[model samples]
Target: MRELHEHTTTTAADALGEAEVAVLPTGSVEQHGPALPLGTDLFAAAGVATRVDRADAIVLPGVPVGVSDHHRQFHGTLSTTEETFADYVADIVESVAAHGVRKVVVVNGHGGNTNALRRAARRLRADDVAFTVPWHWWDNLDDLIDARLDTSLGHADAVETSAMLHLTELVQEDLLADAEAGAADSWGREVPGGADVGFDTADFSDSGAVGHPTDGTAEIGAELVAEAVDDLNALVDWLAAQRFEDLRPAPHR
Candidate 1:
C-alpha cells in the first residue's frame, strides 16, 4: 500500500514527483446502529482507496471525521461544521498540490460530506491549486447495488452493513439479527401537510438504522468493494493521462 502516512519524507517526495493524482479518502466517524462500527465510513473509503490498482496514484491517510451533525444525537458520532469541513478539505488538497501533485481525487464515504466537498472543489478551481473531484463510492455503483438488493442505501442498513462486513472485522455479527429486526424502512418523518422534517437520527429511528440490515452479507460486501475499486481505478487512469492545462478554467472570454 503506497499510503502517504506510511511513506518517509524522501519516499513521498519521489512518489509525488512521479504520481499523477493523489487519492484522499474522506469518511466520517458516526453511529452505524448496533451491528456495525462507528468507523464504517472511514474504513470503507480507505479500503477502496488502498485497493484500487493505480501505480500512478498516491493514497493519503483517510479523513476520520466529516460534516455529520445530523447523526450527532446518536452517541459516538463526531462532526464538524460544514464550513470547517470544507476548509479542512481544501487545506489538505492545497497541501498535497504543494508537493507537485496537480490532480486530486477525494474518495468520499459519507453523504454528508458531498456539499462540503463540492464547495472545496470550487475553491480549488478559483485558486488554481489543483483539479479536484469528489467521488461517492455508492453513487458510482448504483446498477450493481440495485441488482444485489431492492432497498437503496441507508444509514447502517443493508448496504452499509454489507460494506463494513467486507472491509473490516469491526462488525458485531451476533447483533446483526437484532439490529435488522429494529431497522426502519425509511429516513426522517413524512408529514401529510408539510415537508418531511428531521433533526437527527433519533427523530426517525430509535434503532439508529434505516433499511434492512438482515440482507447484508460479507459476500455482497466483497462484490460492492470490487465494483467500486474497479470504477475508481478507471477514473484514476483517465485523469492521470489528462493535461492540467486542458482541465483548467478556460481563458476569460
Candidate 2:
C-alpha cells in the first residue's frame, strides 16, 4: 500500500492483493500554552504520524479539529461534541476501509482526544475493521513520558513545553512564565493555557502541571517521540503476525 496517512491512492497496492494500514492523525486546534500554536495537538500528532508514515504507514490528512470542549475557555480553541467527533472518526475509518483497506491506525495527540479514540475503536471493531489508537501520552511509552517528570506534571508543564521545544521550537516564554506562576499558586497544576482558568480544569493540577516540567528537555522529548514510534511499529508488527485463527472472536458461550 502507498501508506496509512497519505492521500488515498487505490491502485497503489491493488496488484499486491494486500491492504496497507491507513493512519489518521487525530488532534485539536486548541490552546496549548502562551508560547505554542493553537494547533499543538494536531501538530504533535501529525509530527508522529509523519514519522510513522515514513517508517511503515500510509499517513492520512490529520483531523485537526477534535472534541476539545474542555479547552473551549481559550479563544482559538475549537471543539466538537463527543458524539459529533465520534461520528467523524467512524466515518473516516469506514470510508477508508470501504476501499479494501482494513487496517487503520490513529496516531493521536491531545489528552482530550483519548475518549474519542476508545469510542471509535469499539465502534470500528464492531464493524469488523481492525483499528488501534495510541492514547496520546500514555500509549506504549510510559517509561519515557515518566522519565521526563518527577511528579505527574499538570497542563503546560515541563514535559509538554520541552516536547514542544524539541519538536518545533514553538515554546512561548511569557506563557511558560504564566504557567509557572500559576503552578505555584494552583499547586503546580495548569491544564493548557489560553483557555479559562477555573476550578474544574484546575482540580487535577495545582500549578497546572501535576508533574514536573522543571526537568523537561529537548533531548528527553526527542527520545520520548522515538520510543513512541518504536512502540507503534511493534504494535503494527504484532498485528500483522496474527492470522484468521489468531483473531477469532471468543464465543460468548
Candidate 3:
C-alpha cells in the first residue's frame, strides 16, 4: 500500500512526483447501534481506499469526522457543520493539488457527508485547484446489496455490519440480536403527502440502525470489498491515463 503517512518527507516527494491520483478517505465517527462500532464508516472507507493496489495512486490520511447531526441524539456521534466540512475537504484537496497530483478520488463512507463533499468537489473544480470525485463504496452495488441482504444501505444494518466484520473485529457480536430488535424497517417516517418528519435518527430507530443486522456475514462483506476495490482500480486506471489539462473546466463560449 502506498500510504502517504507511512512515507518520510524524502520518500513522499518521489512518490508524489510519480503519482497521478490521490485517494483521500472520508467518513464519520458516529453511532452505528450497539452491535457495530462508532468508527464503522471510517473503517469501511479506509479499508476500501487502502486496498486499491495502484502504483500511480497515493492514499492520504483519512478524515474521520463528517456531517452527522442527524445522529446527535445517539452517544458518540461527533459532527461538524456542512460549511465547515466542505471547507475542510476543499482545503485538503487544494493542498494535494499544490503537490502536483491534481486528480483526486474522495472515498466517502458516510451518507450525511454527501452534500458537503459535493459542494467541496464543485468548489475545487471551479477554482481549478483540483479535480475531485466523491465516491461511495456502495455506489453501483445496490443490486448486490439488495440481493444478498434484501435491503439497501442502512445505518448499522447488514451491509455495514458485514463490512465491519470483514475489515475489523470491532463488532459486538453478542448484541446483533439487540440491534435488530430495535432497528427500523426503513429509513424515515413519511406522511401521506410524502413529507418526512423524522429529522433525527432517534425519531425513527431506537437502535440507530435500519434493516436487518442478523443477516450480515463476514463472507458477504469480503465480496463487497472486492467489488468496490475493482471499481476503484478501474477508476484510477482511467484517471491516470488522462492529462490534467483535459480534466479541467473549459472556457465559456
Candidate 4:
C-alpha cells in the first residue's frame, strides 16, 4: 500500500510524482449500536482504501468524523457541520492537487456524509483544483446484498455488521440479537400524506439500527469487501488512464 503517512518527505515526493491518482477515505466516528464499534464506518473506508493494490494510486490518511448530527442522541457520536466537512474535504483535495496529482477517488463509508462529499467534489471540480469522484463502498452491490441478506442497507445492521465482521475484530457478537430486537423495520417514519416525519435516529430506531443484525455473517462480509475492492480497482484503473485536463469542466457553450 502506498500510504502517504508511511512515506517520508523525500519518498512521498517520489511516490506522488509516480502516482496517477490519489485515494482519500472518509467516514464517520459515530454510534453504530451496541453490537458494532463507533469506528465501523472509518474502518470500512480505510480498509477498502488500503486494499487497492495499485502503484498508480496513493492513499491519504482517512478523515474519521463526518456529518452525523442525526445520530447524536446515541453515545460516542461525533459530528461536524456540513459546511465544515465540505470545506475540510475540499481543502485536502486542493492540497493534493498542489502536488500535481489532480485525479482523486474519495472512498466514503457513511450515508450522512454524502451531501458534504458531493459538495466538496463539485467545488473542487469547479475550481479546477481536482477531479474528484465520491464512491460508497456498497455501491453497485445491491444484488449481492439482496441475495445474501434479503434486505436493503441499514445503519449498523446486517450489511454493515457483516462488513465489520469481515474487516475487524471489534464486533460484539453477543449483542447482535439485542441490536436486531430493537432495530427499526426500515429507515424512517412517514405520515399518510407521504410526509417523512422521522428526523433523527432516535425518532425511529430504538437501537440505532435499521435492519436485522443477526443475519450478518463473516462469509457475506468477505463477499461484500471483495466486490467493493474489485470495483475500486476498476475505477482507479479508469482514472489512471485518463488525462487530468479531459476530466475538468468543459468550456461554457
Best by lDDT: 4
> Top model by TM-score, which number?
4
- For candidate 1, the 10 contiguous residues with the lowest summed lDDT are 193-202
Clashes in model 1: which pairs? none
Give lDDT tens digits, candidate 1, residues 71-188.
Answer: 8887899999889999998999999999899799999999899999999998898789999989988777777778998778888988899998888888998888787777777888
Q: Candidate 3: list runs displaced more than 4 Å.
A: none
The predictions' CA RMSDs to the true structure, in order, are: 1.2, 5.1, 0.9, 0.8
RMSD of 4: 0.8
Q: If both were scored by lDDT, which would come out higher, candidate 2 or candidate 3? A: 3
Q: Report the lDDT tens digits of candidate 3 across residue range 1-253.
A: 6699999999999999989999999999999999999989889999999998767899999999999999999999999999999999999889989999999999999999999999999999989899999999889789889888778888899999999999999999999999999999999999899999999999999999998988999999999998999889988899888888898888899
The 0-to-1 C-alpha lDDT of every candidate, in the order given, reads 0.88, 0.63, 0.93, 0.93
TM-score of 4: 0.98
Between candidates 1 and 2, the one scoring higher on lDDT is: 1
- Model 3: clashing residue pairs? none
Q: Is candidate 2 or candidate 4 better by lDDT?
A: 4
Ranking by TM-score: 4, 3, 1, 2
Poorest 10 consecutive residues of model 2 by lDDT? 181-190
Cα distance off (Å), candidate 3, residue 122: 0.7
lDDT of 2 by residue, 207-251 (tens): 333334455577877876777777766666666555534453466
